[model samples]
Target: MELYRSHVLVCAGAGCISSDCQAVKKSLLDSINRLKLDKEVKVVETGCMGPCDQGPVMVVYPEGVFYRRLKPADAVEIAEEHLLKGRVVKHLIYQTPETGSAALTFEQIDFFNKQTRIALRNTGIINPESVEEYIARNGYQALGRVLSKMTPEEVIDLVKKSGLRGRGGAGFPTGLKWEFSARAQGKPKYVVCNADEGDPGAFMDRSILEGDPHSVLEAMAICGYATGAGQGYVYVRAEYPLAVQRLNLAIRKAREYGLLGENIFGTGFGFDVEIRVGAGAFVCGEETALLASIEGRRGEPRPKPPFPAQGGLWGKPTVINNVETWANIPPIILNGADWFAGIGTEKSKGTKVFALAGKVNNTGLVEVPMGTTLREIIFDIGGGIPNGKKFKAAQTGGPSGGCIPAKHLDVPVDYESLTELGAIMGSGGLIIMDEDTCMVDLARFFVEFVQDESCGKCSPCRIGTRRMLEILDRITKGRGRDGDIELLEELGRGIKAGALCGLGQTAPNPVLSTIRHFREEYEAHIYQHRCPAGVCKALTVYVIDEEKCTGCGRCAVVCPAGAVSGVKKQPHHIDPEKCLKCGTCMEKCKFQAIHTL
Candidate 1:
């Protein structure tokens, strides 16, 4: 192996890529070559480094210097000062928000300190395209151990004992799913990896596939070995071009290295993987729907009684798990069931990877142990609500999940606990809402999202969610009636019970959970004829207080509706009839004069 004096690890994840981390990578390579230090230096693009708020991030190994918000121009200075002269770039160092002390390493940052990176172990650390890099991090060691020694039954038994539930929302026992497929009488059984992640703010699957494709590949192969399945398929969305490309590369390399395709590591167990592209339908996330799509049929879900385990792909038994679930498999194999089980809460073992988004200070991907409190995730790790706003609620499980109010902030996030709160741990999308966010509007937003994404396969989900959305829209628009809340609850429950698949069953989650926790907000919108957060336009009326208005003309000049009227240095009055309730006057008012009622 050739030794390099320094290694520059640049984030190439979707977030960083959007922030132009690719330019940073190009600059580093070009600079290194120009400086005639190519032989002595190595530049590698890796996955997300968390802390997306400080993106276009790069880390220098050996010294472990963390640099944030790197511009293409800053690359020369980084190369000249840090790489060549061996002096740290003080200005680029990530500083502690409270103390202002420079955080020298990635682990020192609070964003990464609270995270337990089991599924994301190799991400952001290794060059994913290189098989040798993956090998250096004990990538295929679990597969080698399983194939060389452990029997299929023993593997299944160990996972069952581990208590690792699915990370893909449903929290179903992974080992149990595998066992069903293993026990089923069938020839040429198959394993599938569900990578068609369509959740709004969710990117857990994308990160794993991009950062550590080998993990999923290895785990799927392990699953195939245990279930007597010789063929494997990774059904990924076409939207994830990067993930797809990397997965293709990973599979090709794995096959060439004898890790995939035919006999692997001299075990005589033949296994190969193929990629299936999804048309980006949200319903295809369900196992049965996914199978139909892969089979080149319409992507609609079928009723399960003959669950995929009994009758699946090409009319044979099949084992399917999401990307995050498969990513956890290899680790569970390498580290004993007890070790894996010891990490998380009872009944819900192992860490969960959440895409922390919305009005939080540090928004990015976070993986924490199962029992970690929402308070810790929001206040401690997330750095609390942004702009000094009070934390109102958090929407978990994407559109299919519920909104947990401030009272539930301390709620320990586990599969059972969240479900008890009328929320599922669906795909781990944690969207934090602040005081400025209207609960009614929030509920309406999700209802509209789900209603639009509904496959219309089942009437309960198709019609029920639309009806719920219509009611929510009416409520937000100040057209709600007295019995609207009761109607919503009834409809939500009916949809939950009657929906055919997980999508429809959980479709009313946002409305149901919000009503359960923040029913007063809904009532305030209906009875009081007011939006507490002043977010719903129909319920909000903007007015400039004459006593406080400085007549700076800022509000008048910026108002798109031309509602504000006054001369300079005099109090301005807003014409209510002409006002569109756009909130531009309030936003532009410098004297705190504009108020929304």
Candidate 2:
């Protein structure tokens, strides 16, 4: 075995790859070779580190010195200073958001210290493509334990006792779902991992697949053993090319090692998995629709009576769980059920992985205990709103979720509590909004997303979402009716009650929840004919303050609409009709003179 004195772990997750981590990696390697330190130093490509915004990130082990936001030049300097000379690169270290002080190691950064990583344990810690590294971290130990010592019934009981509800949006009891498939009379049962993570701004599952693909593979084999099946399938979306590639590699590696193929551990039991790539349909995130897509049919949700556990995948009894849900399985098996259950609240157990984005200082992946409050996630973990802006609301659960107002910041983020707030924990996409965000426009944006993604199989989701979207569109365009709010509420309620499948039922969440919390904003849009956040171009006008404006022609020079008119050193006036309300003038002005109303 080749032993290296130091290992450099570079973040090769999708975000970092787009940020040119490849170039940085090459430069680091070149510098290391140039310095004749290639024997002592090793570079390893790993999956996402939670803090994605600071991409092209790398950490030097032994010392664990963290470096962020690196260019090729920065990589070379780190290779020279830190790798060769044993000096830490101070300027490239992550600066604490609260204080401008540098956090040297991953542990020193609050973004990492605050997170409880279960689904993300191996991510950014090891090379995802290397099954050897995964094995070194006790990766397949759970599956081996289950096959050798525990019975199928015992496995189910352990999971049930763990209090692990499905992490795939619907908080269904995973053990109960497995038990249902076990008890159901069928031939050649199946285990399916739902990798169709379609939520906007969600990459939790993708990161897991990219980082620790074997965790998911091992869990599926366990599920197959528990459910009396020999075959499993991973239905991943086509959008995640890297995730799919890693998954295929993991499967191949598992098969080679007899971890996936027949007669594992000489126990006369065998399980294997295959990958099925989806065509990036958001509706496919729903289990029934996902199953349909796996069957090579048009993805559409069917009414439940015969759920997936009873009759799924070519009319055979099958157990299906999403990527995050499956990733939690190995941990529950290795660690005791009580250990898992003890971590979270009574109903919602274990930690949740959230793709934290929008308006926050630390925008990346965050995993915390189930009962962690919004304030803790936003303030302590997320570093609050950017540029000293006040937090207005947080949109959880994607299009199926409702907006949580500032008053609910202290609310414990559990399945029941979020549902109580009209937001379902739909796969952990938390978008923070600052005070400057227009609620009406935000609601409209989400509603439009839902409407566009609707499969149109059901009229309630199809026509009803369209109606609500049209009303929201009119409201944002300064042509809202007196009863538009009431009409939206009515339509939203009707869709929730009448729409088929979970998608349609939860489609009106954004509009309804925004109305429930920010009714005043809606009133301002409808009655006052204005957008309080000045986001709606039709309802907004940019004005220059005479007291602040120096009549610098900077605004006039940049205005594509040519609306600004004034002499030098004089306050400028804007023709509202000619003004595009693009906010380009405000961004261009050296003095903070332009104000939006």
Candidate 3:
């Protein structure tokens, strides 16, 4: 084996890649080769390191020095100073959000320390494209042990004992779902990994698939073994090309290593997996719709009861589990069910992976135990809201979920708890909000997303969500009626009850949850024709605070519209008629003169 004295691990996740992580990789390699240190130093591209706010991130192994926000030009200095001479790059070190102190180790930062990383176990720690790295980390051991020692029924029983419900938002018991498929009388029973994650701002599954594709592949093979299915399909979205590529590569490598494609540690058990690309439709996230898409049909959902377990995928019994749910199976089998069950709350077991985004200081992926409070995730792990902005609310579960207000910040984030508070754990998309965000506009945003994504198969979802969006649009535009609030509630409830699939059923959640928690905001929009957050443009106007203005002319330079008239070093005046309500003046003013009202 080739051993290097120093290893430079560069982040190659989508976010970092967009931030020119590839250029960082190239520069490090070129510098290493140029410096004659190629034999002693190696550079490898790893998956996400979670602190996406500081992207183009790289970690030096053995020493574990973390460098953040590197430009292409910064790479030579990093290689020459750190990799060549073993001296740290002081300028590139991560700045601690609170104290402004530089942090050397990424794990020591609160953003990484608070995360558990079960599904994302090997991500950022190993080369994802290398099967050898996966094997060294105890990758396919669970499959070998299950095939050689445990029976199919035993595997199912172990998973049942683990108390792991599906992480794809339904919270269905995974073992029970597998058992149902195992017992159902059908030929060609199939296993499907639902990677068509269409939820806006939800990338938990995508990160797992891109970072640790082997885990999902191994877990799916385990599911195939336990359920007596020989064939598997990973229905991933075409939009996630990186995830698809990694998954494809992992499958090929697993086949070469004899870990997949008919067999097992010489145990004669046969199983294999294939990848099916989705057409980027949100409705394909539904189980039946996903199955239909895999079968080369339109991605439309059918009413259940003759559920997927009984009749799925070409009219044969099929077991469908989401990517994250499948990723947890191997660990549950290896660690024993009781150990897994003991970590989370009474009802919801194991950890959840959330795409922590929007108005958060540390915007990235986070995996915490089920019962961890929202306050910990929002404040402690997320480094609180950015720029000292007061926390307003959090939106969980993507378009299919709801907004949780400040009153529920202390609520424990579990399946039942979030549901009791009027939010579902739908694919674990947590978008934080600050005092500047408008709750009514927030509801309208999600409603518009659902309205556009609705398959139009059912009347309640197709027409109801559209009407809801229309009402929210009117309210935000200062054309709301006195009865609009009650109308929204009535319509939201009807959509939830009358919809055909989970997508439609949960489409009204954001509106309902926001109204339930911040009804006063909705009332303000309807009755007073005002947006408390001053975010709704039709109801918002920018004015200069005479006491604070210094007439810097920065606001005048930035305003797309010529709304501000001021001389240098004097108080400014804002022409309300010319102001576009873009808040450009507020952002540009250093004196805190511009106020949105």
Best by lDDT: 2
lDDT of 2 by residue, 273-374 (tens): 999999999999999999999999999999996998889999899899988989899998999999999998989999999999999999999999999999
Cα lDDT tens digits for candidate 1, 1-597: 789989999999888999999888888888888888889889898987777888899999888888999998788889888888899989998977545688888778888888899999988888889989999898999999999999999999999999988888898898999999999998989999999999998998998899999999999899999999999999999999999999999999999999998889987998999999999999899889999999999888999889998889988999888999998988899989999999889888989999999999888889999999999998878888866789999999999999898988889999989989988899999999999999889889988988998889899999999899899999999999999999999999999999999888999999999999999989999999999899999898887788998879999898888888999999988898999888877876678899988
Best by TM-score: 2
lDDT of each: 0.90, 0.93, 0.90
* Candidate 2 residue 218 C-alpha distance from true site, Å: 0.3
All candidates: CA RMSD in angstroms?
A: 1.3, 1.0, 1.6
State every prediction's TM-score relative to the real structure. 0.98, 0.99, 0.97
Clashes of each: 0, 0, 0
Q: What order do candidates take by TM-score, descending? A: 2, 1, 3
Overlapping backbone residue pairs in candidate 1 total 0
| Predicted candidate 3 versus true structure: per-residue lDDT over 302-347, tens digit per residue | 9998999999999999999999999898888889998889988998
- Candidate 3 — which residues are off by over 4 angstroms? 550-562, 565-572
Local error of candidate 1 at 119, Å? 0.2
Give model 3's TM-score versus the native structure: 0.97
How far off is residue 486 in model 1, in Å?
Answer: 0.4
